[model samples]
Target: MKMFGLRLLLTVFLLVLLELLVINIAGILPFIASHKANISDAPYMEFITDNLQHPIESSTHMIEEKNPLFFLGSGAVVLFTIYATFFMKGGKGKYELADKYGVHGSSRFAQRHEIFKQGETVGVPAKQLMKDLEASMLVSKGEK
Candidate 1:
């Protein structure tokens, strides 16, 4: 299971990395190619064009080139991938973050019909009451 999760994470990360590379390359190609004639003349534009034209060198290194938006977008992808790779897993158990705080647990509910049969309140089963500490505490505290 752990291996599968790791594979899935790696697959997603690679796909995103590829997507960012493709988009960056595609997006800057036109700008650089269109301005190629004058790119060599403008020092700042040449620098910007070169930076934008390069692929991401490493996970920590990013070349925004000319499109800051695409650079930021790629950064977002990297952040999300890192976060998911470290934190997410494939299972309903992953959604149990709420359980960590004790928001959910064993619980029992009495049917309304069962509770008010013939217009009289029926006592809930003791086992169900014990599942809820509030009910048990109420009974015990009353005696004290």
Candidate 2:
């Protein structure tokens, strides 16, 4: 769980970095382009200094003027991070079951249903099966 949390944090960091890169590029591209005809001729250091001195002021107007795509990109990144962090399953047990029983499916619900069916087939009571499943999951996760 600690490892997973670390990984999640890293993933979120990378996503935010990507969003910032996109937004910054969108915000600064026009200013940079208009400053000079050639890329090499642009006042790169001065632009950086100005932005550093007034980061929000420098980017706000440009961001406001640009199309909604920049905001959409940020929103998409946030949504993706949320989905990945909270909704995604690690599925170690599912993969273990698949390898053991040859069951195949990507859906977590179907995978769990198949496990329940297998437990029933093996004469395990539903209540006991659920307990066993929970125990196994905890053990697999190193929480028990």
Candidate 3:
């Protein structure tokens, strides 16, 4: 439970970092335009200059194309963070867990439907698959 909480915290921090990355990307000056926008403006004309977002101009963008290793590494980290965060032991289909911790039936109902589907696709015996499907369906009924 403590581990899951920490993982959740890290996931949120990563998301905030991703948002900063997006803002930096948005700050990048356009090299070309659709011809509708004036290209030869105050900067090119000289004497006068204006930036769309001067504050943004200070931040440099990560060049993913030029740095494939960095891109792949960061992407893997982000993906792993996401997987560790919301892949709940908490709830499914409508029946939510009470403790919502990483224990007991905050333990038992852990992704039953998804697990059943994966097992079925991987050729787990049909009888086992059926049992899993039924169990998931039964719990999802929320009748207790």
Candidate 4:
């Protein structure tokens, strides 16, 4: 739920766009059905019969308004409600938690580095993990 707001915005935009596409396609099918004309050597309008989208506006009428934007908006709202409520959530922040913590954090949380080399700590734990190895080893020896 980190980017819940962003997700809602994107989902709403996409769903509304989808609704618009469906509605427009429903309205525009007749024009596509009509302009069965095409380009071909077989005279005016017979040989190229199978060709789609003639792009002529002679007999095409404007898209009819069967479904209003208000209804479309309402439907989009319902869709978004369903989406935001349950559909997209992934098992209670499974991926979100994994991503929020650095990817290396999950695997390696070094606590008091026991610097082991060649199967042993060489009876020491500080020198190898330090930048100034000689000084660190002396400090470790002094501490011991």
Prediction 3 TM-score vs. true: 0.26
Which residue pairs in candidate 2 have backbone atoms (N, alpha carbon, C) closer than 3 angstroms, thus clashing?
A: none
Cα lDDT of model 1 by residue, 41-80, tens digit: 5455554455446544422243434555566666666777
**Candidate No. with top TM-score:** 2
Report the Cα lDDT for candidate 3: 0.51
Candidate with the larger TM-score of 1 and 2: 2
**Deviation in Å, model 2, residue 39 alpha carbon:** 3.3
lDDT of 3 by residue, 60-140 (tens): 333523444435545765775677577645436333534343444354554556455754656679999999999898889
Off by over 4 Å in 2: 1-8, 44-59, 93-144
**lDDT (CA) for every model shown?**
0.59, 0.68, 0.51, 0.49
RMSD to true structure for each model, in Å: 14.3, 15.4, 19.8, 11.1
TM-score of each: 0.31, 0.42, 0.26, 0.33
Question: For residue 12, what is the lDDT in candidate 4?
Answer: 78
Q: Look at candidate 1 and give me any clashing residue pairs.
A: 52-65
Arranged by lDDT, best first: 2, 1, 3, 4
Ranking by TM-score: 2, 4, 1, 3
Compared with the true structure, what per-residue lDDT tens digits does model 2 show for residues 6-111?
A: 9778887877666656555555667665765677877777766675566567547656676465667667878887787677896677557653455446334445
Candidate 4 residue-wise lDDT, 1-144, digit = tens:
768887678777776555444444443444344544642332433312322233122112222333344345446766776776558755656555654444554764544433444656545456555756766788889963
Which residue pairs clash in candidate 4? none
- How many residue pairs collide in each prediction? 1, 0, 1, 0
